[model samples]
Target: MQPHEKVKQYLDTICEQIRYKRIHNELREELENHITDQKQAYIAQGMDEETGTFKAVEQMGDPVMVGTQLDRTHKPKPEWSMIVLTLLLLLTGTFIRLYTAPRETNGLELFYRQLLFTVVGIGLMTLCYKVDFTILGEYSSILFFALAAIIVLLMLVINPVDGRFIYASYPLLLFPALFAGVVYSMSNRGYSGVILCGIYFTIPLILSLLIPNITITLFLTLSYLVILTIAIQKKRFKVNQHHALLLVYVPFIISFVVAMTNNNLIYRLKIVFTPSLAPMGVGYMGNITRGIMKGARLIGQGALPENLQGLTVEQVLPLINSDFLLTYITHRFGWIAFLIVVALLELFIIRAFVLCARQKSVLALLVSTAVTLTFAYQTLGFVVTNCGFYLFAPLSLPLISQSSHYLLVNMSLIGILLSVYRTGHMVHDKRFPEKPDRRPFLTIEDGRIIIDLHLD
Candidate 1:
């Protein structure tokens, strides 16, 4: 074929490929069927198959050019407006709690702290967005090392003699330090950074429970799991080792063996099923479960004056506002409000998963998986720790967490997600110019494909 005819044939081949591949399966099938019919028509018009195919190719134009066009149409618009709405809801709720609740506490102090946390989180997110995430992979070891250092420092606080008061809180400071360390370590080990991060949070979860502060542990775990799941589903991790059963089974075996050998371990394990077994230790969960059950009995009646008599929810569970804020919300706002909060959280999880599945971006998929897993895991943990009257504890929900640490953690995640949505390349594709110049096309390198176009 002449150069012009060659170009036409090339363009047609490209267009056909794009038509069959990128489109919905049904649509692609239909388009292929139509192309077959067109080929037959050309043959009937006294054209040979080669000439007919060439005609089909000529009519189709540049595939890259068409793909680019299709991409423009398909790109998911950033949900800036919904993001703003979520932020507003969070801020409004914070404000209500700060100034206008049935009673108010250090409104100014709470506002300033929360505002500072949000600002810092946003700044970090901005930095991450500007830098390529792939670069972070190079520094995963160093990052993990730093996190390990933090965990060691936290471990020091775990000793009461160190005057660290780790026990006073659920080794509160150690939770973040340990989680970040584990995640970093996993990331360096060529695991999915996000999933590793989620797994790492389990350290804090276990410690929090040991401190008998199931609320905070559950919340932190949830946040971490959601983030990690997003990473896994997106294939952010280097390996796809399906080792969930092994991971869980090994831990269970170790715990059971240790519990049989150690009285303390046995005692703690017993408390898992029967909180009454370890009154002081299990009381945290029991009290939360009982309080919510009591409130459930009242339903729309709201917190009774008798129930409100100088009794702080914090007295029932330390850091109740942040970790066990749901109790307060349900108590004052009623069961309907509780249901709404749960529903909204479910919606966010579902949306993240759906968007991840639909998006062509691998990174976005990873991020979505991270978020979904984190939320689902945490939520389940929270319910387990709180649900049955026999088992209960205060745990904060995502986005609605009132604790300064939990709030900071949640905001940091949101900021990262916002950054990803704003700056990510959703899918990898290349588009060539529709009109070809007289210059001869040269060899294309990896990730590069060129199509020469001709009007005739």
Candidate 2:
């Protein structure tokens, strides 16, 4: 046998003992390099080629033992804590929904629906955990455009709840994650790439604008801002930091300004800050929510004011199962429920952020960070609205909101997050490799136009 065959056979035997195939290549490389180094060291001491190789393999303990040790070391591990937390949150949401809902046919119906979403959500989370998410980064552009196309298409269909096409903003919830992929794809493309990101952002921005859905508009705006900031801070772009930031925020700033001036959004903000100004108008829910909070006791069933016109407290603000679930729990049960819910949600987001930020792969880090921020913002929006700030019209707490549509969206986001944490160690990405000076799309030498057919 050739001298190198000994090393090859050693590695093969070692790999055979390791069951997790995902790290097989890395394990093989590590062992091969180590054996080669030992063989060369022996050769430097005047040993012949075959003797060096044989001696190296013999001195290294049994391949089975080595591989067994490594098999235990290198394996794909899921974040069971996050998984358990997710299931707990889902159960909390289901219980709260049934608790808030009337005890009748309608309540049982809601129970069944929540049960279905919960089961489906768990299944989706499991599937996402099993599948690798790195491939999403591979087809980043396709996913972005496909998402953009869906946003545009959804704009044409009217949302039944709000009677507005843009109000059907479910797709907008995922904009942040796919944008992470776009940001990764545009890596090393320079200022032009950064500008393309802004351009791509406009599709959803405009849809949100026409839909005039402030919640999603702000969701998209903040998501891109945070993500691009991360990219620029990391020097992922090939342009000046200041310049790339300018390119990124120009559209957001413009949208913010346009939204403030155009949509009576300014009036809405005014009422949210000072609910009494429109106590029976846009601020009705906020005003009632504050009333409920003021009357809430520390541990017992709090009383709703006698003046309010409602058969039950749910009739006062009407979103008992979703946007106002926290408020309902606080007022109806006690402050303890509120604290528990807040603690769980806060823990989930905080820990998720800590985990996501630790990702070694750039794409994984970016995507997971974006997902975390989306969760954070939506939670803030929902909590603030429940805590007597602007009702925000349609903000829903992640797992706490029991709506069918949002249940799916929230589950999908969790699934993606679980996917990231599950594969954080298993999947690696080359998102920022130095590119070869391959053929350019266009050349302008000698005032002549040369379109290069070779695309890298």
Residue ranges of candidate 2 with Cα displaced over 4 Å: 1-19, 25-64, 103-105, 149-162, 166-168, 210-212, 261-263, 309-311, 431-456
How well is each residue in 322-343 modelled by candidate 1, as lDDT tens digits? Answer: 5445555566566665676667
Off by over 4 Å in 1: 1-77, 80-85, 99-108, 125-139, 149-281, 297-320, 358-364, 378-396, 420-456
How much lDDT does candidate 2 score? 0.78
Provide the overall lDDT of each model, using Cα atoms, as 2-decimal numbers: 0.49, 0.78
TM-score per prediction, in order, is: 0.54, 0.82
Against the correct fold, how does model 1 do in TM-score? 0.54
RMSD of each: 14.2, 5.4
Error of 2 at 381 (Å): 1.0
